[model samples]
Target: MPVESSALPPADTVSVAGLIDNIRGRDHRQSRLAWEIYTDIERIHALTLDRPPELDTRVFDHFANSSALLGAVNHIDKSHADALVNEALALVHRIPLTGLCLYDGIINQRQFQLLVSVTDLVDGWPSAPDVDKQIAKDLQDNGPGSTRRLRDLTKRAIFAHDPDAVRRRAEQARARRTATVRPRPDGMAHLGITAPAEDAQLAMAAVEALIAAAICPHDPRKKNARRSDAAMNTLQGIPLVCQCGREDCTATPRGAGMSDLHARIVVHVICQDGTLGGDSHDGGGPDEGGPQDSPDGGPGSEDPGGDGSDDGPGDDGPSDDGPHNSGPECGGDAERPGFLDGYGVITADHVRAIAQRPDAIIRPLNPKPGQALPTHQPGDPYRFSAALDTFIRARDGYCVFAGCNKPAWACDLDHVDEFNHDDPAAGGQTSAGGANAKCRYHHLIKTFGEWLDDQFVDADGRTRVTVTSPDGVTIEGRGHTNEMLFPALRTVRFQKPPPRGPTTPAADDPNNGSGPRRTRTRTADKHARRRRERELNRRFRELHDFGPPPDDRR
Candidate 1:
């Protein structure tokens, strides 16, 4: 029998046309604002256009650097202001098609900026115009879903139109690989190594393997902290030893000796959990923790716990020494991409190639369909289980905050619905379905700033998020899942465990259906400070008559 009309849920009455119009209207306003900013920058540029380099005049010095003046006006860094001017001018002049798209509201400012960046190398190439036209047409036809997709589309257009230019740029970039150290605050420094994509991934994999082998799972240090220490140890010929202090710790490296001199290296190459057909566990080989030569080429051999055994079946055969598989069987979903952890997405071919390396070790992380991953129910600890934590990090590749792209691994797993510390059984279980990756800043804002974040799984199983600002402006986003990179994750589902006890009475609960206590949000504080600063600056401008008549040193 058909359900009664009133009993049924109300149909979605939102108008698609109205939404599109609203978006277009906003885009147009933003485009106009960008143009206004560009004009202001141009006027500033004109002031110093033909100034003499040898001029010692105070007036000339003050007007010479447009970026400095603009920075002062905007209360921003000079370098940042310079970059903004350059970007604005480039959009208007170099890539006019993209600029037109911006004007027509076909693409937003961020997308335009991304296009400008990708097309930078091919600016003077022969097919640059064609590339621009293609990008504009593609965006007009089917706009990218996200900035990541926009970047992917822009890069594809560049590769298609200017293949030679792309090749030349890649070659040039490869030749320029180097390592550098920059001093940081508080007696710290940043060490960066620029290398080929494959090399970087491999190096990271090696470091990860060292961490895995040297430290126990119960180690006090976080993965990131351990990674830093492991990298340092590897670089300095020191042992990546366990600091857990447990006498029976399974980690091999106890102290600096023969074993310490020769630590095993196991490079983990993640692929799809199983065969392309998804029916069998015929992917990923056994972990091969083979003894690797020390940084000083010193030779030492000891079984680092891994005895090469057939952990599973795949196209590759069991090899006691190294991987024998040429590559993964290519067809259907087998060609799905994989990510390089700290790096960006890599193709299936790259994944297969890395897996087939002589020194590589394949560790399969299988995602079983319809299986319930670890979840915190009532009476259980509030913290998410290790398995659930890993899944959440992988599922939400980055922070769920609207514009933040901070990697999920580095973010705090925040409960979208405030977890009831007073009464856990009432609601907000520490489960995969209830949690979202939020960077510290956004987390703090969500807690203190009257910001509301709602996360739900749609009918199609996509994780949808809506973040509402204090003023009621809502921004919609979706989790950047690993399903694209690791196809096996597509089948994985999170079923929120049911509450273990009787629900708490709405009246009795301290939250009373409301979120955290509202406070003067940091964002509001920053805006208020900026407004006061701007007002003061304006008043000073009126009183001082243009900054002490421009440094009177002649």
Candidate 2:
């Protein structure tokens, strides 16, 4: 049934059903409007269909199409309108299925944009139609669910159908890596580095470590402020000093020792053993035969960060067991791709290239029927074991919260069920099955808010999660787990560790004793600021605005 605007009550008075109806109505309208715009552009394009197919002619045609809509759109610049028109043309002509999906209300504007952007390189290939069809089917059957998931799906489709194009794009992107600085509205500037994912991750980790070591926890500066200060100090090759007033602060760097900045970059790349030798498909086909050399010949290229040596402190130098073929043990074919922790899916050839690096450490994760993995249960150690921690991080891949893409390596390992400190025997066990990676913000919400999350292994061996909001609304997802991308993860499972012997709680433990008191509660500060804002808003509303300055009024 068509939605009627008259049927929906006012925002405050609308029922749940009414609100849902109103949302769907707006969605349908948006889709219809997009279709109409696409058709309009098509008509404009038809007017010059007979023109020569030269690059300059195409540019001229685009300008003509955009010029026709100069004064048509309201409250938008001509340049912005022109970009929109060009995008519409690309959608309808290049990736036809995505445009059709948008017209059918299967995806929203953001989702459409992501699909177009990710598939931009693949759309010119012969296999582009297959990629488009598969994406449309995935979107229609399962729904993109979130923009993050949509991007992953689109990239995966492009890669699966056209690996060469994906590799070409990656090489081109790698060549364009550069650092930039931009001015902001406030008296601040934005510093950006367009480096490779691994390089950026390492640089970020080093900066954060410096910031933490430079000041005591009691420093008054906010996190962002401290980050800026630390970054500037490091860039200028200066030693960072403690900002705390106390002269005896432990975090204070005594000498130029703070100038020595280094981070142990451990990029967790999960993949099958076969992937390390190059893609399985590379054995056969014309273009796909054998491992292709990287743009800089091999992994030994003069890449600034790719020195192929793990010299940083506390770095684990590969596994003891070493590289072993885990195909049969992991229950997957040989063509599976690899997943970089912060980066998304990478090709099998790319994985092999990483493996060829002298610093690369390849460890096979083989799951035997009764193999014992590390686990923490009950009592003394509340932390998951190092091996178990690594497994869980690789499994979940990112924050389990819907739509969040924060990589697992940077996230905290959160227990799905809260652990009981007072009585450890009765609490949630810290094991692979019960633990997941959650970014700090979402972890705090799950701990304090009325949100509830339940995780369970599906019959197909994939981990599934369902999150319920305070209002009782629920959403189910695969928790953005990489087990889907790497099938080997699915085969690995840890038996719940045996309960540990109970031990007396330490006197200094925060949960056992009264924790260090805060100067002011977060809730109190929030309420105070909001109350002042309300008062100011009321005062501003009561005072009438003068029409303009005296000269302008004339």
Candidate 3:
């Protein structure tokens, strides 16, 4: 209103010198806007459910059909919008936590989904309400962590509340296990199997074991190529140490006795000399290692990079969760705790526990590349030798497609230049470095479909694949390195968690980390709740110890 106000600069540049660090009122305004959005969503859900019970199936059908119409008008995909509407209805009817989180306006949609997914894990617990509240608080405590960390916290909560439930869930999951195959475009099909967590983890470990013994540093194959070769051999029922260390299990060695399972699975364990004594390390939860450079690079210190391992269910696999061989580390120990997975990150301790199994196969992973791969038949340059096969398999840890982490060991090895039998000159060189690790379906796509791909290897031997789609779009993918994530595992140990510091936006999106700011009110409420719980438990224990008023007869 003032004349001077009209002459002011744009808001972003108008801050006073000392005011740059201050919080703006607009931050709180965002929270208010979120609250309004939640309210509107709730209203839409109510309108659907409030339909007369007498309308029965017709009303239900309307709820489903009308959502598509609404989504269409809004230019949102119908199925996804319908799903959102249904989820909102469920929140109002089933979970009250959403309302609480919405009221605070600090929890964004992703956080909400994470909270809901974890809370649902407690569904069968005897004390669902208490578990829900506890889980909700734990989610809030972290503010917004990585999606992986959030999932790990959910695991921590589950185990802390009910170990028995975990055991039961694992058993139930195994009973529901299955291995299925689905066809993809072209002649390719997806192969997926779900077994016990221990079995699954051990099976994956065996492949890595083979790759380590065969792959060499100068070998041309990428990480994915090596993995693909290893996986195929493993699937052929190679004499792997089956049973995952479970002594009493009647489960026979997979592919055993039959020619199918006769492939020899030899394990080799090699590690540098090291002494174990002092506790100078700690572990992060299942998904993270500490961010700092370890002063001593202690036994448990993170090794920086390792490829991922398949440890859970996929699109059509069995129950994902199971009783682990190892328990989760307490809190945020940074002594490089956690195991590296197929995705090259370590956060779960069960990986080690699985490795500890008596029947688990162990093998050496030479950091420097091993012997030169073989090229059989001096007269012919087309037959890839076993050593060359191993080289390529080890180089590629999984499929070479961008973001498609299907274990390379279980994929197909195809020649990049397309092998030729009729014309010797036209035939591609049969060498480990010239191979690619591609999944069955993806391979078919490259071979017969309108897809064209080319590869280039860096001087350091990391291979890159550029894929051109039927459309004009082109995307590039780089293969994993040959580094091991846990090289000092023989003496590794869990240490204390790293210190907490500032919170940062987890993702690059602007929508992230814009939730309501923390205040003294949160801390005070947390402390008060602790006091109340202690008082309640104390009173209950006192009552329990009284033994029914001493029994008048006694």
Q: What is the lDDT of residue 548 in candidate 3?
A: 16
lDDT of 2 by residue, 426-508 (tens): 44556666767777677777666756766766555667666666565555434356665655555555546557676764455
Best by TM-score: 2
- The regions of model 2 sitting more than 4 angstroms off are 1-32, 51-59, 67-75, 100-106, 145-147, 181-191, 244-248, 254-265, 278-336, 349-359, 367-374, 377-383, 417-433, 457-461, 496-554
What is the lDDT of every predicted structure here? 0.54, 0.58, 0.42
After aligning candidate 2 to the native by TM-score, how far in Å is the CA of 471 from where it should be?
1.2
How does candidate 2 fare on TM-score? 0.69
Clashes of 2: 0
TM-score of each: 0.48, 0.69, 0.40
- Candidate 3: list runs displaced more than 4 Å: 1-38, 54-66, 76-79, 90-95, 102-106, 122-126, 156-172, 237-554
The order of the candidates by TM-score, greatest first, is 2, 1, 3
Lowest summed lDDT across 10 adjacent residues in model 3 is found at: 317-326
Compute the lDDT for candidate 3.
0.42
Against the true structure, what is every candidate's RMSD?
18.1, 14.6, 23.9
lDDT winner: 2
